[model samples]
Target chain A: EDKVVQSPLSLVVHEGDTVTLNCSYEVTNFRSLLWYKQEKKAPTFLFMLTSSGIEKKSGRLSSILDKKELSSILNITATQTGDSAIYLCALFMEYGNKLVFGAGTILRVKS
Target chain B: NAGVTQTPKFRVLKTGQSMTLLCAQDMNHEYMYWYRQDPGMGLRLIHYSVGEGTTAKGEVPDGYNVSRLKKQNFLLGLESAAPSQTSVYFCASRRLRITNTGELFFGEGSRLTVL
Candidate 1:
Protein backbone atom coordinates (compact mmCIF):
# COMPACT_ATOMS: atom_id res chain seq x y z
CA GLU A 1 0.00 0.00 0.00
CA ASP A 2 1.10 3.57 -0.64
CA LYS A 3 2.15 5.34 2.53
CA VAL A 4 3.52 8.68 3.71
CA VAL A 5 5.09 9.06 7.11
CA GLN A 6 6.16 12.20 8.95
CA SER A 7 8.54 12.13 11.86
CA PRO A 8 8.38 13.81 15.30
CA LEU A 9 4.58 13.95 15.15
CA SER A 10 4.88 17.13 17.23
CA LEU A 11 7.53 19.73 18.01
CA VAL A 12 8.03 22.72 20.25
CA VAL A 13 10.39 25.60 19.55
CA HIS A 14 11.07 29.05 20.91
CA GLU A 15 10.87 32.19 18.85
CA GLY A 16 13.90 32.82 16.60
CA ASP A 17 14.75 29.13 16.65
CA THR A 18 15.35 26.95 13.61
CA VAL A 19 13.54 23.67 13.02
CA THR A 20 13.37 20.88 10.49
CA LEU A 21 10.43 18.59 9.71
CA ASN A 22 10.83 15.27 7.94
CA CYS A 23 8.63 13.36 5.53
CA SER A 24 9.24 9.94 4.02
CA TYR A 25 7.10 8.10 1.52
CA GLU A 26 6.88 4.61 0.03
CA VAL A 27 4.57 4.52 -2.92
CA THR A 28 4.21 2.92 -6.34
CA ASN A 29 4.01 6.00 -8.56
CA PHE A 30 5.76 8.95 -6.95
CA ARG A 31 5.42 12.18 -8.82
CA SER A 32 5.69 15.20 -6.53
CA LEU A 33 5.66 16.16 -2.86
CA LEU A 34 3.71 19.09 -1.46
CA TRP A 35 3.73 20.88 1.87
CA TYR A 36 0.90 22.79 3.49
CA LYS A 37 0.28 24.85 6.63
CA GLN A 38 -2.99 24.45 8.50
CA GLU A 39 -3.96 26.96 11.13
CA LYS A 40 -7.44 27.55 12.51
CA LYS A 41 -9.10 27.06 9.15
CA ALA A 42 -8.24 25.18 5.98
CA PRO A 43 -4.77 24.38 4.85
CA THR A 44 -2.77 26.75 2.69
CA PHE A 45 -0.28 25.59 0.10
CA LEU A 46 3.38 25.93 1.04
CA PHE A 47 5.73 24.40 -1.48
CA MET A 48 5.79 21.68 -4.15
CA LEU A 49 8.98 19.74 -4.70
CA THR A 50 9.43 17.57 -7.77
CA SER A 51 13.11 17.42 -8.57
CA SER A 52 15.67 16.22 -6.08
CA GLY A 53 18.66 18.13 -4.73
CA ILE A 54 17.16 21.51 -5.59
CA GLU A 55 15.64 23.56 -2.81
CA LYS A 56 12.47 25.66 -2.86
CA LYS A 57 12.37 28.68 -0.62
CA SER A 58 9.89 31.29 0.57
CA GLY A 59 10.90 33.98 3.04
CA ARG A 60 11.80 32.04 6.22
CA LEU A 61 10.65 28.62 4.99
CA SER A 62 12.46 26.27 2.64
CA SER A 63 12.13 22.64 1.50
CA ILE A 64 14.05 20.06 -0.46
CA LEU A 65 13.40 16.59 -1.84
CA ASP A 66 15.83 13.65 -2.14
CA LYS A 67 14.48 11.08 -4.56
CA LYS A 68 17.33 8.70 -3.80
CA GLU A 69 16.25 8.57 -0.15
CA LEU A 70 12.53 8.77 -0.87
CA SER A 71 12.32 11.55 1.68
CA SER A 72 11.92 15.31 2.01
CA ILE A 73 12.59 17.97 4.60
CA LEU A 74 11.09 21.35 5.44
CA ASN A 75 13.20 23.92 7.21
CA ILE A 76 12.04 26.99 9.02
CA THR A 77 14.55 29.62 10.02
CA ALA A 78 14.09 32.41 12.60
CA THR A 79 10.74 30.95 13.49
CA GLN A 80 8.13 33.10 15.15
CA THR A 81 4.89 32.52 16.99
CA GLY A 82 2.99 32.92 13.74
CA ASP A 83 4.66 29.75 12.46
CA SER A 84 2.72 27.60 14.89
CA ALA A 85 0.50 25.22 12.97
CA ILE A 86 0.28 21.70 11.55
CA TYR A 87 2.71 21.19 8.72
CA LEU A 88 1.36 18.61 6.31
CA CYS A 89 3.22 16.51 3.78
CA ALA A 90 1.40 15.03 0.81
CA LEU A 91 2.46 12.87 -2.08
CA PHE A 92 1.03 13.17 -5.56
CA MET A 93 1.04 9.69 -7.04
CA GLU A 94 -0.59 7.81 -9.92
CA TYR A 95 0.48 10.42 -12.43
CA GLY A 96 -0.68 13.17 -10.08
CA ASN A 97 -4.20 11.72 -10.08
CA LYS A 98 -4.15 11.02 -6.36
CA LEU A 99 -2.84 12.84 -3.32
CA VAL A 100 -1.85 10.77 -0.29
CA PHE A 101 -1.02 12.67 2.89
CA GLY A 102 0.94 11.91 6.02
CA ALA A 103 -0.26 12.28 9.60
CA GLY A 104 1.51 15.71 9.69
CA THR A 105 3.86 17.38 12.17
CA ILE A 106 2.43 19.75 14.73
CA LEU A 107 4.75 22.69 15.33
CA ARG A 108 4.40 25.06 18.24
CA VAL A 109 6.52 28.19 18.25
CA LYS A 110 6.47 29.84 21.65
CA SER A 111 7.11 33.51 22.10
CA ASN B 1 -12.36 35.26 -5.94
CA ALA B 2 -14.10 32.55 -3.98
CA GLY B 3 -11.75 29.82 -5.07
CA VAL B 4 -13.76 27.03 -3.46
CA THR B 5 -16.77 27.09 -1.13
CA GLN B 6 -18.42 24.49 1.12
CA THR B 7 -21.82 24.97 2.64
CA PRO B 8 -22.99 24.15 6.18
CA LYS B 9 -19.66 24.87 7.88
CA PHE B 10 -20.94 22.80 10.84
CA ARG B 11 -23.49 20.08 11.38
CA VAL B 12 -24.60 17.54 13.96
CA LEU B 13 -26.74 14.48 13.45
CA LYS B 14 -27.91 11.34 15.21
CA THR B 15 -27.17 7.83 14.06
CA GLY B 16 -28.87 6.85 10.82
CA GLN B 17 -29.55 10.47 9.85
CA SER B 18 -28.71 11.46 6.30
CA MET B 19 -27.22 14.63 4.87
CA THR B 20 -25.27 15.98 1.95
CA LEU B 21 -22.28 18.29 1.87
CA LEU B 22 -22.07 20.72 -1.00
CA CYS B 23 -18.95 22.00 -2.73
CA ALA B 24 -18.73 24.73 -5.31
CA GLN B 25 -15.81 26.18 -7.22
CA ASP B 26 -15.65 29.35 -9.23
CA MET B 27 -12.27 28.72 -10.81
CA ASN B 28 -13.84 26.59 -13.51
CA HIS B 29 -11.58 23.75 -12.56
CA GLU B 30 -12.20 20.40 -14.21
CA TYR B 31 -11.07 18.29 -11.29
CA MET B 32 -12.72 18.31 -7.86
CA TYR B 33 -12.26 16.13 -4.79
CA TRP B 34 -13.77 15.45 -1.36
CA TYR B 35 -11.64 14.53 1.63
CA ARG B 36 -12.08 13.94 5.35
CA GLN B 37 -9.63 14.90 8.10
CA ASP B 38 -9.48 13.16 11.44
CA PRO B 39 -7.14 12.99 14.40
CA GLY B 40 -3.93 11.16 13.47
CA MET B 41 -5.21 10.97 9.89
CA GLY B 42 -4.06 13.82 7.68
CA LEU B 43 -6.52 13.79 4.84
CA ARG B 44 -8.15 10.86 3.06
CA LEU B 45 -9.81 11.19 -0.27
CA ILE B 46 -13.34 9.91 -0.21
CA HIS B 47 -14.38 10.65 -3.80
CA TYR B 48 -13.30 12.74 -6.76
CA SER B 49 -14.60 13.89 -10.10
CA VAL B 50 -12.56 14.59 -13.17
CA GLY B 51 -15.24 16.60 -14.87
CA GLU B 52 -18.92 17.13 -15.07
CA GLY B 53 -21.00 13.96 -14.74
CA THR B 54 -18.10 11.78 -13.75
CA THR B 55 -16.88 10.42 -10.39
CA ALA B 56 -14.33 7.98 -9.00
CA LYS B 57 -13.51 6.41 -5.65
CA GLY B 58 -10.34 7.11 -3.71
CA GLU B 59 -8.53 5.54 -0.77
CA VAL B 60 -11.50 5.44 1.62
CA PRO B 61 -14.80 5.67 -0.25
CA ASP B 62 -17.02 3.36 1.73
CA GLY B 63 -20.24 4.71 3.29
CA TYR B 64 -20.09 7.75 1.03
CA ASN B 65 -21.67 8.70 -2.27
CA VAL B 66 -20.85 11.55 -4.63
CA SER B 67 -22.33 13.19 -7.70
CA ARG B 68 -21.13 15.79 -10.19
CA LEU B 69 -24.07 16.75 -12.37
CA LYS B 70 -22.59 20.15 -13.20
CA LYS B 71 -19.08 21.38 -13.76
CA GLN B 72 -19.10 23.80 -10.86
CA ASN B 73 -20.70 21.72 -8.14
CA PHE B 74 -19.96 18.42 -6.42
CA LEU B 75 -21.94 16.89 -3.61
CA LEU B 76 -21.13 14.21 -1.02
CA GLY B 77 -23.95 12.32 0.66
CA LEU B 78 -23.93 10.16 3.75
CA GLU B 79 -26.97 7.90 3.80
CA SER B 80 -26.61 6.93 7.45
CA ALA B 81 -24.40 8.80 9.82
CA ALA B 82 -22.21 6.98 12.33
CA PRO B 83 -20.11 8.23 15.20
CA SER B 84 -17.08 7.01 13.32
CA GLN B 85 -18.03 9.39 10.55
CA THR B 86 -17.51 12.46 12.68
CA SER B 87 -14.84 14.44 10.92
CA VAL B 88 -13.93 17.63 9.13
CA TYR B 89 -14.76 17.38 5.45
CA PHE B 90 -12.82 19.44 2.93
CA CYS B 91 -13.48 20.16 -0.75
CA ALA B 92 -10.76 20.97 -3.22
CA SER B 93 -10.38 21.67 -6.93
CA ARG B 94 -7.67 21.98 -9.52
CA ARG B 95 -7.47 22.55 -13.23
CA LEU B 96 -7.49 19.60 -15.65
CA ARG B 97 -4.12 20.38 -17.22
CA ILE B 98 -2.30 21.45 -14.11
CA THR B 99 -0.14 24.44 -14.74
CA ASN B 100 2.92 25.54 -12.81
CA THR B 101 2.77 24.05 -9.30
CA GLY B 102 -0.47 22.12 -9.81
CA GLU B 103 -1.61 23.15 -6.38
CA LEU B 104 -5.18 22.56 -5.23
CA PHE B 105 -7.58 25.23 -3.99
CA PHE B 106 -9.48 24.11 -0.91
CA GLY B 107 -12.62 25.22 0.85
CA GLU B 108 -12.93 26.40 4.45
CA GLY B 109 -14.18 22.87 5.39
CA SER B 110 -17.26 21.47 7.07
CA ARG B 111 -17.21 20.14 10.62
CA LEU B 112 -19.58 17.20 11.19
CA THR B 113 -20.35 15.33 14.39
CA VAL B 114 -22.44 12.16 14.35
CA LEU B 115 -23.90 11.23 17.71
Candidate 2:
Protein backbone atom coordinates (compact mmCIF):
# COMPACT_ATOMS: atom_id res chain seq x y z
CA GLU A 1 0.00 0.00 0.00
CA ASP A 2 1.14 3.55 -0.69
CA LYS A 3 1.82 5.36 2.56
CA VAL A 4 3.00 8.76 3.74
CA VAL A 5 4.20 9.37 7.28
CA GLN A 6 4.81 12.68 9.01
CA SER A 7 6.92 12.93 12.12
CA PRO A 8 6.10 14.87 15.26
CA LEU A 9 2.37 14.86 14.63
CA SER A 10 2.16 18.09 16.60
CA LEU A 11 4.66 20.78 17.57
CA VAL A 12 4.71 23.94 19.63
CA VAL A 13 7.22 26.74 19.25
CA HIS A 14 7.63 30.34 20.29
CA GLU A 15 7.51 33.12 17.74
CA GLY A 16 10.68 33.75 15.70
CA ASP A 17 11.68 30.09 16.12
CA THR A 18 12.69 28.13 13.09
CA VAL A 19 10.84 24.87 12.54
CA THR A 20 11.30 21.90 10.29
CA LEU A 21 8.50 19.46 9.40
CA ASN A 22 9.28 16.09 7.88
CA CYS A 23 7.40 13.93 5.42
CA SER A 24 8.37 10.48 4.12
CA TYR A 25 6.57 8.39 1.56
CA GLU A 26 6.73 5.06 -0.23
CA VAL A 27 4.73 4.72 -3.38
CA THR A 28 5.00 3.30 -6.89
CA ASN A 29 5.56 5.60 -9.86
CA PHE A 30 6.01 8.77 -7.90
CA ARG A 31 5.40 11.92 -9.90
CA SER A 32 5.70 14.83 -7.47
CA LEU A 33 5.39 15.96 -3.88
CA LEU A 34 3.15 18.80 -2.72
CA TRP A 35 2.84 20.77 0.50
CA TYR A 36 -0.23 22.65 1.72
CA LYS A 37 -1.19 24.80 4.70
CA GLN A 38 -4.63 24.47 6.30
CA GLU A 39 -5.82 27.09 8.73
CA LYS A 40 -9.57 26.66 9.33
CA LYS A 41 -11.05 26.01 5.92
CA ALA A 42 -9.58 24.35 2.84
CA PRO A 43 -5.89 23.81 2.49
CA THR A 44 -3.98 26.33 0.41
CA PHE A 45 -1.22 25.27 -1.91
CA LEU A 46 2.29 25.97 -0.74
CA PHE A 47 4.88 24.25 -2.89
CA MET A 48 5.40 21.37 -5.30
CA LEU A 49 8.72 19.56 -5.56
CA THR A 50 9.53 17.11 -8.29
CA SER A 51 13.26 16.98 -8.89
CA SER A 52 15.60 15.99 -6.12
CA GLY A 53 17.98 18.52 -4.55
CA ILE A 54 15.98 21.45 -5.91
CA GLU A 55 14.40 23.64 -3.23
CA LYS A 56 11.16 25.52 -3.71
CA LYS A 57 10.61 28.58 -1.59
CA SER A 58 7.89 31.10 -0.89
CA GLY A 59 8.81 33.95 1.48
CA ARG A 60 9.45 32.44 4.95
CA LEU A 61 8.61 28.89 3.82
CA SER A 62 10.75 26.52 1.80
CA SER A 63 10.67 22.81 0.88
CA ILE A 64 12.84 20.22 -0.80
CA LEU A 65 12.32 16.66 -1.98
CA ASP A 66 14.85 13.84 -1.84
CA LYS A 67 13.50 11.20 -4.15
CA LYS A 68 16.31 8.79 -3.40
CA GLU A 69 15.49 8.97 0.29
CA LEU A 70 11.74 8.97 -0.37
CA SER A 71 11.30 11.96 1.88
CA SER A 72 10.75 15.72 1.95
CA ILE A 73 11.15 18.50 4.49
CA LEU A 74 9.38 21.84 4.97
CA ASN A 75 11.23 24.60 6.73
CA ILE A 76 9.85 27.81 8.16
CA THR A 77 12.19 30.63 9.13
CA ALA A 78 11.46 33.29 11.70
CA THR A 79 8.01 31.88 12.18
CA GLN A 80 5.09 33.95 13.39
CA THR A 81 1.76 33.04 14.96
CA GLY A 82 0.24 33.29 11.50
CA ASP A 83 2.35 30.32 10.46
CA SER A 84 0.65 28.10 13.01
CA ALA A 85 -1.45 25.64 11.08
CA ILE A 86 -1.58 22.05 9.85
CA TYR A 87 1.10 21.42 7.25
CA LEU A 88 0.26 18.59 4.90
CA CYS A 89 2.51 16.70 2.49
CA ALA A 90 1.25 14.47 -0.27
CA LEU A 91 2.78 12.24 -2.91
CA PHE A 92 1.28 12.17 -6.37
CA MET A 93 1.43 8.90 -8.24
CA GLU A 94 1.95 8.66 -11.99
CA TYR A 95 -0.79 6.21 -12.93
CA GLY A 96 -3.95 7.81 -11.65
CA ASN A 97 -2.37 11.06 -10.56
CA LYS A 98 -3.82 10.29 -7.16
CA LEU A 99 -2.54 11.92 -4.00
CA VAL A 100 -1.60 10.02 -0.82
CA PHE A 101 -1.30 12.45 2.06
CA GLY A 102 0.42 12.27 5.42
CA ALA A 103 -1.42 12.87 8.65
CA GLY A 104 -0.37 16.53 8.77
CA THR A 105 2.02 18.12 11.25
CA ILE A 106 0.07 20.53 13.42
CA LEU A 107 2.30 23.49 14.16
CA ARG A 108 1.50 25.85 17.00
CA VAL A 109 3.54 29.02 16.96
CA LYS A 110 2.93 31.04 20.09
CA SER A 111 3.75 34.70 20.54
CA ASN B 1 -11.35 33.89 -11.34
CA ALA B 2 -13.68 32.07 -9.00
CA GLY B 3 -11.11 29.27 -8.78
CA VAL B 4 -13.07 26.36 -7.31
CA THR B 5 -16.45 26.53 -5.58
CA GLN B 6 -18.50 24.03 -3.55
CA THR B 7 -22.20 24.34 -2.87
CA PRO B 8 -23.89 24.20 0.57
CA LYS B 9 -20.86 24.91 2.73
CA PHE B 10 -22.57 23.09 5.63
CA ARG B 11 -25.33 20.51 5.88
CA VAL B 12 -26.96 18.08 8.30
CA LEU B 13 -28.62 14.85 7.25
CA LYS B 14 -30.50 12.05 8.95
CA THR B 15 -29.13 8.53 9.00
CA GLY B 16 -31.01 7.44 5.88
CA GLN B 17 -31.27 10.80 4.13
CA SER B 18 -29.50 11.41 0.84
CA MET B 19 -27.82 14.51 -0.56
CA THR B 20 -25.49 15.64 -3.26
CA LEU B 21 -22.54 18.03 -3.02
CA LEU B 22 -21.68 20.12 -6.04
CA CYS B 23 -18.28 21.42 -7.15
CA ALA B 24 -17.40 23.84 -9.89
CA GLN B 25 -14.12 25.19 -11.16
CA ASP B 26 -13.58 28.20 -13.42
CA MET B 27 -9.97 27.47 -14.20
CA ASN B 28 -10.99 25.25 -17.12
CA HIS B 29 -8.96 22.45 -15.66
CA GLU B 30 -9.10 19.04 -17.22
CA TYR B 31 -8.68 17.04 -14.02
CA MET B 32 -11.07 17.22 -11.04
CA TYR B 33 -11.19 15.27 -7.78
CA TRP B 34 -13.29 14.77 -4.63
CA TYR B 35 -11.83 14.12 -1.19
CA ARG B 36 -12.93 13.74 2.42
CA GLN B 37 -11.15 14.96 5.52
CA ASP B 38 -11.79 13.67 9.02
CA PRO B 39 -10.36 14.67 12.36
CA GLY B 40 -6.76 13.52 12.90
CA MET B 41 -6.81 11.73 9.53
CA GLY B 42 -5.40 13.14 6.31
CA LEU B 43 -7.54 13.79 3.27
CA ARG B 44 -8.62 10.68 1.37
CA LEU B 45 -9.69 10.57 -2.25
CA ILE B 46 -13.24 9.52 -3.01
CA HIS B 47 -13.57 9.90 -6.77
CA TYR B 48 -12.14 11.92 -9.66
CA SER B 49 -12.68 12.83 -13.26
CA VAL B 50 -10.10 13.37 -15.96
CA GLY B 51 -12.52 15.20 -18.20
CA GLU B 52 -16.13 15.57 -19.07
CA GLY B 53 -18.03 12.27 -19.26
CA THR B 54 -15.27 10.33 -17.51
CA THR B 55 -15.05 9.30 -13.88
CA ALA B 56 -13.00 6.88 -11.74
CA LYS B 57 -12.93 5.65 -8.18
CA GLY B 58 -10.16 6.58 -5.81
CA GLU B 59 -8.90 5.21 -2.49
CA VAL B 60 -12.19 5.68 -0.61
CA PRO B 61 -15.10 5.42 -3.05
CA ASP B 62 -17.43 3.28 -1.02
CA GLY B 63 -20.87 4.68 -0.05
CA TYR B 64 -20.48 7.50 -2.55
CA ASN B 65 -21.23 8.25 -6.17
CA VAL B 66 -19.92 10.91 -8.56
CA SER B 67 -20.82 12.44 -11.89
CA ARG B 68 -18.93 14.73 -14.28
CA LEU B 69 -21.35 15.77 -16.93
CA LYS B 70 -19.36 18.88 -17.81
CA LYS B 71 -15.72 19.78 -17.77
CA GLN B 72 -16.10 22.43 -15.09
CA ASN B 73 -18.40 20.59 -12.72
CA PHE B 74 -18.19 17.48 -10.52
CA LEU B 75 -20.82 16.21 -8.12
CA LEU B 76 -20.64 13.80 -5.18
CA GLY B 77 -23.70 11.94 -3.95
CA LEU B 78 -24.49 9.93 -0.86
CA GLU B 79 -27.40 7.56 -1.25
CA SER B 80 -27.83 6.80 2.46
CA ALA B 81 -26.09 9.03 4.95
CA ALA B 82 -24.29 7.34 7.85
CA PRO B 83 -22.42 8.76 10.79
CA SER B 84 -19.24 7.41 9.31
CA GLN B 85 -19.92 9.46 6.20
CA THR B 86 -19.81 12.72 8.07
CA SER B 87 -16.74 14.60 6.96
CA VAL B 88 -15.44 17.74 5.26
CA TYR B 89 -15.51 17.28 1.51
CA PHE B 90 -13.10 19.10 -0.78
CA CYS B 91 -12.97 19.52 -4.52
CA ALA B 92 -9.76 20.02 -6.40
CA SER B 93 -8.69 20.53 -10.01
CA ARG B 94 -5.48 20.61 -12.00
CA ARG B 95 -4.26 21.07 -15.50
CA LEU B 96 -4.04 17.97 -17.64
CA ARG B 97 -0.83 18.58 -19.59
CA ILE B 98 1.12 19.44 -16.49
CA THR B 99 1.63 15.86 -15.45
CA ASN B 100 5.03 16.23 -13.84
CA THR B 101 4.00 19.35 -11.97
CA GLY B 102 1.08 18.06 -9.94
CA GLU B 103 -0.23 21.27 -8.46
CA LEU B 104 -3.88 21.14 -7.42
CA PHE B 105 -6.13 24.11 -6.64
CA PHE B 106 -8.79 23.36 -4.05
CA GLY B 107 -12.22 24.69 -3.20
CA GLU B 108 -13.50 25.83 0.17
CA GLY B 109 -14.67 22.59 1.79
CA SER B 110 -18.24 21.54 2.47
CA ARG B 111 -18.81 20.38 6.03
CA LEU B 112 -21.36 17.56 6.30
CA THR B 113 -22.85 16.18 9.47
CA VAL B 114 -24.85 12.96 9.73
CA LEU B 115 -27.02 12.18 12.71
Q: Which sections of candidate 1 miss by over 4 Å? A: B98-101
Q: What i-RMS does each candidate reach, in Å?
A: 1.3, 0.9
Per residue, candidate 2 scores C-alpha lDDT tens digits across B1-115 of 7999999899999999999999999999999999999877889999999999999999999999999999999999999999999999999998888445778889999999999
In angstroms, give how far residue B83 of model 2 lies from its true place: 0.3
**Chain A TM-score of prediction number 2:** 0.97
lDDT of 1: 0.92
Backbone clash tally (model 1): 0
lDDT of 2: 0.92
Please give, for residues A1-111, the per-residue lDDT of candidate 2 as tens digits.
Answer: 789999779999999999999999877477788999999988998998888999999999999988888899999999999999999999888878778888899999999
TM-score of each prediction: 0.97, 0.97
Candidate 1: C-alpha RMSD after superposition: 1.2
| Docking quality band of candidate 2, CAPRI definitions | high
Q: What is the lDDT of residue A70 in candidate 2?
A: 84
**Model 2: which residue pairs collide?**
none
